[model samples]
Every structure is written in structure tokens, then in C-alpha cells.
Target: MKKPTPYTVSARLYDLISFEWPVYGAGRSTAISLLDLAPGSHVLDMGCGTGLNFPLLQRQIGPRGSITGVDASAQMLAQARQRADSAGWSNVTLIEADATAVNPAALTPHQRFDAAIATYALSLMPTWQTALLTMISATRPGGQIAVVDMRTPTGAAAVWTPLARLACRLGRSDIEAHPWSDMPQRLARVRSASVRGGHIQIRVGSVGRDGDSVPERDAALDPPRQR
Candidate 1:
């Protein structure tokens, strides 16, 4: 298999896979449920991927809210645009930029966000720490960051850490070498000078076929097309 630009690999299949697969749907539910905002919450769908979570975010945040979908792929953004146009989602903004390299001031100059969410996108980044930290940086006081990604299984197979090793060997795009397996713990230790908001990170790891939903298995996915 040849390496394709993130957009090329995702454009058609991105929307298809997300909708067709029950995992993405369930995971999105989990992510959107965590937002817990009153109204007018600025939600960031990091790794927005065809804007699968856009509607859910909008519904949670309601009419007073707004969302921005950031993806490194312009092609993916194009597909997302189709969804936005189809649904007439004017509040959702699509910005094409590398997540780790995004300018925080450019994202929200005057105000910070109520929540930041990434579904199945963290593992795709080469520098996930930067990506993760960037999300935290963009958050406002009392805001929350919800990241859902694959976890490195502990002592599975005839291997100890074989999954992570295999992910590394899988090259890059299609497979995630290092996942946010320990985000909850890592976030707890990460000190920020902010006052009102206390950090709460919950790390979950499971060994099941629900890889697509859970974010760890991360196998090559092919979701069906929407009518």
C-alpha cells in the first residue's frame, strides 16, 4: 500500500466509515455527552474528519453555540464542506491546518472554548503530545478537553507491548504507532497556571473487537456510503 495524503485516504471513506460503523457513532455519543455546557459554548472538533461529530456538538451546544473543525487535509475539509452545505450548518467553521501547528490566537482571539473534542484522530499525529497540549492550551477557564484515542494494551499475545511495536512498524498514516493510552494520567500531572479549572482526565483501555469505536485497534476502516 502506498502512503496517501490524509485527505486522499479519507475523503470518500471518511463520511462513509464514520456513519456505517457503529463504533464511531457510539464514541461520538460518549464525546458529546461530556461537553455539559449551558449555551454558547465554543466547541472544537479536533480531527473533525468529515464533520461526523458536528451535528452532535451543535445539538449539545445548541443554537447559541459554534464549532470549528480542524483537519490537516484539505480534501477532508472539502468532504466536510459537503456535509455542512447539505445540512446548512453555518455555525460550524472548517479550518485546514496541522493540529499541532495551529495558531491558538488565530483560533479564538477574544474568548476561549467551553470544550475541545477529538474522535479517533489523536493517534494519527506524529507529535500527539503537542497536539494534546495544544488542545489544553486552547481551552478556557472551567473548560474541558475530551480526547478519545487507542490505547496500548498491556501484556497481550506472546508479547509485551507488541501492539505499540506493530503500530510503529506499520509506518504512519493507516496505523497509529503511539496512542493516547495514558492521557488521563498525563493530564493530571501536567501543571498549568490557570485558576478556576481543575483537570480531570480519565484513561480507558479495553481488548475487544470494538477497536473502531474505542480508538485502540485502529485497523484500516471502510465505512459505507450514505444515501
Candidate 2:
């Protein structure tokens, strides 16, 4: 297989990592771990590139629930649409729009979602804070927000930090791309963060209306793949 380019990396990695996290268990845990949503729940997926979480959500919510995937990248939206079509999923809708700029008028007035989710796209965002506030605004007051990203624990450049830097250096990417440092807390302030999980290095968190003492679970990023 040809190596994935930078522009194509987002779409290419969708399916590969989508089911790998296993949040608490396997794919089942990962899917449920995204949010504590009930059946027939309506969800808004922010920056929902290629709709990685769409399949699990679709299955969980059944035919009655609806999900709208909003992404700024047209290529990603196209890929997501293709994936949904291939899966014969009619409940998923892909829209070419920035998460931060979503207007209530864009969807039906009666289409307020029960929860919103963004997977791995948090760090990729430019203004992650504004993007999150937009996420908060898009949902109902008591709605839930599930966020996942490549998180780095705060510490001086330790062993793994240097290794991560070396990898980025060799790859000509930003070695100091510590994207999750303050973004999670910023998001948590907007909504109480609950059940934070992921490899300890790359954390994913779930934020909702009524959370006070959600525990952080350890998870590793770039886990060695199963042969």
C-alpha cells in the first residue's frame, strides 16, 4: 500500500483507529464510552470525518435515532457519505460545514440533538475552544458532549516525550504539538467532563450537563497493532 499523504491521512486513518480504542471493553465499550446516550437519541458529530463513529452509533440508536455528521472538509464529507451509502445507512447525514459555525437554522427547529460527539478531530481544530463552545451551543442545555483526542500528560520532556518528538522530527511534523494540554479543561468548564478514558497518553473524555467528579481512565495512543 502507498503511504498515506498528509491531506489524506484524516480519511485514511478513520476506520483503522475508529474501532481500536475499545474505550472500556472492545468496540462495544468504545461506542458506548463515547457518550451515555439512550436509545433513539439524536446526535451531532462535530468534525465527523469519514464518519468513523457513525456505524457504532447507528447500530446503538437503531432506525429511530438520527445522526448528522458535520465537517469542514469536503473530501471528508464525501468519504463519509460514501461510507454511509455503502453501509445502506439512511439515518446518517453528512454536511459540509465548520463545527464552530453551525447555525440552528441550518437544521429543523425541532432537530435539536440529545448529544454531540467529536472524535480525534479536536486537536486538528484551529480554535479548539471556540469549536467546543459551538459544540456546547449546538446541543440542548442538558445534552451531552463526547470528546476524544491525542492527549499528552503535563510534564517536562521525559523519555516518551523525547521519543514522540523524535518521531515527529523524522516525520517533519511539529514535535511540540501538545494539542490537548488545556483544551480538555476548557471544554470541561463549558460542560462537566465525565468518564475520561484512553491510553494514558492519548486521553478521550465525555462531557455532560451534570458531572462533578468524573474519573480519568488511562489509555495509550499509538498502541502496537494486532497482527
Q: Which candidate ranks first by lDDT, i.e. highest?
A: 1
Relative to the true structure, candidate 2 has a C-alpha RMSD (angstroms) of 7.3
In candidate 1 the C-alpha lDDT for residue 106 amounts to: 72
TM-score of each: 0.68, 0.64
- lDDT, candidate 1, 1-227, per-residue tens: 54455557648775554432532355455545544556788887888878888877777777778888888777888888898889877788888888888986677777767777777677678777777766766766446666655433332222434543454344243234334444533333211110001111122222122211222232222222211
Q: Cα miss at 130, model 2 (Å)?
A: 1.2
Candidate 2's displacement at residue 34, Å, is 5.3
RMSD values for the candidates in order, in angstroms, are 11.3, 7.3
Best by TM-score: 1
Error of 2 at 36 (Å): 3.0
lDDT of each: 0.58, 0.57
lDDT of 2 by residue, 1-227 (tens): 64333335556554564444533123223434546567798888888777777877886787888898888777678788898899988888777776656674474357567777766565555566666666656666556666655433234424355544443343334423444454355334222221223222233344434322233433433333222
Error of 2 at 141 (Å): 1.9
Where does candidate 1 stray beyond 4 Å?
1-4, 18-20, 152-182, 185-227
